[model samples]
Target chain A: MNEQSITLKKKPNLGRRIGDEIKRNFVLYLMAIPVIVYFVVFVYLPMYGLIIAFKDYRPFNRMGQGGIWGSPWADYYGFGNFVKFFQSPLFWSVIKNTIYISLLGTCFSFPAPIIFALMLNEIKNLKYKKIIQTITYLPHFISMVVICSMIIRFFQTEGILTKLITLLGGEKQNYMINEDAYRPIFVGSGIWQGVGWGSIIYISALSSIDQELYEAAVIDGAGKWKQLVHITIPGILSTIVILLIMNIGSILSVGYEKTILLQNDKTASVARVISSYTYDLSFGEGNSDFAYSSAIGIFQSVVNIIFLTIANTISKKVTDSGLF
Target chain B: MVYKPSIGEKVFNLFNILFMALMIFICFYPFWYCVTCSLSKQADTASLMLLPNGFTLATYKDVLAREAIQKGYLVTIFVVVVGTIINLIMTTIAAFLLTRKNFAIRGFLTWMMLFTMYFGGGMIPTYIVYTQILGLEGSILVLLIPGCISVYNMIVMRTNFNGIPTSLEESVKVDGGNDMHVLWHIIIPLSKAVISVMVLFYGVGHWNSWFNASLYLQGTEIQPLQLRLREILILGQTAAEGDAGDVSTMAENIKYATIIVATLPILLVYPVIQKYFVKGVMIGAVKG
Candidate 1:
């Protein structure tokens, strides 16, 4: 009787459990039907379009049937596009610029928010805290286009920022067009726009920390700095790790629009990152080398995926926190 | 009990308050500059004015007098309102579905959303799909459909939905109310704060969008305000660049005028929606 029951249990294993779940939640699945269909069409299907990176990518080849994936010349490139990218003249420049900008951002942009959150949390006055938070929060809501315009204008030869910089012995010309200035400008603007928004999560995390810990520490004669180090830092360490992992994973992705707008021939060597590069190559001369452009994009996404996986695995192993 | 602070604490507090005030000034200065330049006379616009000096509505008149700007404003308003409603419906229903316990496909669906967040077919493939396959090029639907559901926003909505007590839904179920009824009454009422914040977020997204319009709806009459703003601000054009390319005083004055006009609505709406955004983030993050 025991053996028979064990055999029966094996029969109702993982697949059977899933089948039973499907049967039990039929109505719930119905509620999610539209979203499922939307994801299938808009998201999953386009992911298959990444296959075009391997093909010659003729519209005619894709037109007959199977659409974006079933191109007649699927193997025409056969890693050729990726190989061409590696050998391309602009390859090193794009890679260098992308890494430089992203790393710069990861260093300054990531820490500014944490520091701001810590500072804001230290404020004892409620009114001053709220006013400061509100003022800082306003920048994140401003449109990127507007932000880019502001940056451009502020760095103009005669603008206020340029005036300040010139007083510090910088040249009296448009700093926006300076190739060497690209990384600094990009990182600076990123900090200005993102620090407040990024701080929100940390601040929220801070608010949820038990007040009794601080009270206890104070009763034990722990100073504010000691209390912050022992209690506050530990309180929000998990949030910090998760956000850091996210930042590291997305180290490859940057805003394409702002980059494009900011980029002219003057700063093209240092300014043209992955997304902007793909955008430029999308409709180049002589039949819009779709294969080449898609390959460049695939190259970017692959590196990003690699970085993301590394980040996830490391965080999961070390801090027991990760996105997956 | 309030703990007494040391002298070091008092000094720190004073310094922090002053630092915060300076930060606030830094935040407000650009908009202040834009407002002043837009309202100032052409000669006065070049000079740095902390306040609006020699203020006039002539720049506003010139900016509004353009035909494309008017059309752009109308289209932007229409898109933001309609698109946000669609976003709310999709997000709410999806969130509710995600929150359903013992959902067999929940894992699958969540993975799908997360995967999309990390990867995509890039812009060209999406462009081809819209233009060649879907035939949405040059249509306003291009703007609306391509970005109908933002994954980040969807996750926020789902997190909020998960935070709602199941007892509320259970009570509705005991009364013989189905999924729609539970969502319509229990879920929607409880989620007013998140929904409102999502509305503002989606509205701002639609308003600030000009890239898709630049790519797909170029030279169309239904171009959005941000595109028009980009033309004047970045492209440095006057009267949409083609109708009249007066690249001098009128362009300069109208540039700031257009910035103020395009951004003023958001500025006004921001304060009202600001608290909701903070609350929304807090609630979503707690469960996240």
Candidate 2:
């Protein structure tokens, strides 16, 4: 009955071992039931519905009997939806728009946070640092809806942003209504919203660097800038790489909600990305092509998976740290 | 601490301080503008300005009196409070159970949860599931049920639970207490920081969520604050009745008022829990 006997005793078979585990942890399994049910219903069941992409789906088709739950994927329209998407005139623009916005966002947003963290680390006064940090981080906690609202309020025709542009000898149109201005506005607002909060991890990483490294550098007559370039960046390099990989992983999956709120007919040409395209196609005027839009969604998810895996692998090779 | 003055270092320090102050100004200026715009006289608010001119509470009074804004506030408060509670309970129970060493098929269960994180059925397919299968579309339950237990939060809570020493639970067991007693008496008490973090995350998520409601629900009555704010601010709808120019100016100011009213609830409480969120991120970054 003691520890020696428990270790010295013959091991049980796999089935017996599992049975014993269940018997011993019945309460835990009972607790897990609801979570298991939630995933099954919400997550797994919907994943199964992704197959509607391959079928000729109609909305009011028999719910479970002859529609999605049936063997609809074996028909002639197996790849018709995908073919139609590939052949569509909107295809190239959607791809270009999504990538353009995402890459622009990543280019600025990914580095802005790192630089913000580095700058914050340089501050000597704790009160000033705390004040600056709180002010910067406040915008992050503000809802995206509020953030978008603020953006629109600033960019209206007679709004402050427009007035400033007119004063500076630029055109006086609302930036939101300008098609060419879409990427800059979207990416700029994205950085303004996320840069402060994104710096959280890097700041946390900065705190973990061994103090002795800085002390040694100081004794060696290295300037603060040199010490920063050497000790600080290297200390946070792995975090940067890991975060970069994640940022790249989400390149295709950048937010659609913000675009949905911001995109009007004037800017839709530049602002219409893959997710929004899918949303529009599914619910827009005469857009009952559920199957077709579902195909687009599948295209996005596949590309996202590929991008994530590639970035993760590159991260593992370069830094020995990856998201996996 | 006693060192000779270096002019370059002093210059660098001055520059850093100025740049940081600029950063703070950039982040905070928009909110400041929103407040000042809401309070400024409608005509004065039309021009580009830093500070409020001819200040009045008319816009705030006007926006708040609207039935739409009131409904939005009520729905948001209900969803945030109720959804966060449901989220915390479900997440804690799931995390606690998953962290148990004796739980069978643990790896499979973990994989099931994590799989959803990487790949998901996109909007149309998920919309079908919600509308056709679950009958959640157009219902308030769409907001409440689908995201009752966020997978990311579950992972964080589970990681936190795993960090706790098993001896605490064992001691409760030794005292002839059941798993529920151990969870209530030990795990819940010990995981307060992480629990609070999860609460804050879920609260903010629910409060700011307009996308799902916008997609699912058809009516404005059950919509949350963010949705109403979205319509007023982004959709460029006028909230007041008047002549074209007069109402448009009032609408712009009223939109700013709505922004302040919508954001102030969360903004007011952020400072107190700021440290907890930073701590949460630090802990999550270590393992996640």
- Candidate 2 stretches with Cα past 4 Å from truth are A1-20, A62-66, A74-77, A315-321, B1-5, B46-51, B237-250
Residue range B40-155, candidate 2, lDDT tens digits: 77634446558776788988888889998999999999999888888988889888877877666688888988888777777888888888788887788888878787788888
lDDT of 2 by residue, A1-324 (tens): 698898768787889888887777788788888889988998788888898888877655445455566645634549888989888999999999999988997778789999999988989899999988888888888888788767776776777777877888988766777888778889988888888889999998999999999888878888877988899999999888878887787777768888887788778899899989988988776776788888988888788878989999877887788876
* Superposition-based RMSD of candidate 1 using all C-alpha atoms, in angstroms: 4.5
Candidate 1 docking quality: incorrect, acceptable, medium or high: medium
lDDT of 1 by residue, B1-288 (tens): 678999999898788778777778878778888888888775243355787767789989988999878988999999999988878888787777777766667788788777887677788777767666667778887777665778877788888787789998899989987777888999899988788989988888898888888888876788898887787677662122233445533445567788888889888888788888888777668767
Whose TM-score is greatest here? 2
Measured against the native two-chain assembly using Cα atoms, what DockQ does each of the candidate structures obtain, in the order listed?
Answer: 0.49, 0.68
- Global lDDT for candidate 2? 0.82
Q: Model 1: clashing residue pairs?
A: none
**Which lDDT tens digits does candidate 1 get at residues A86-180?**
98999998888888888998889999999889988888789878878887898898887788877876776656678778778978877876888
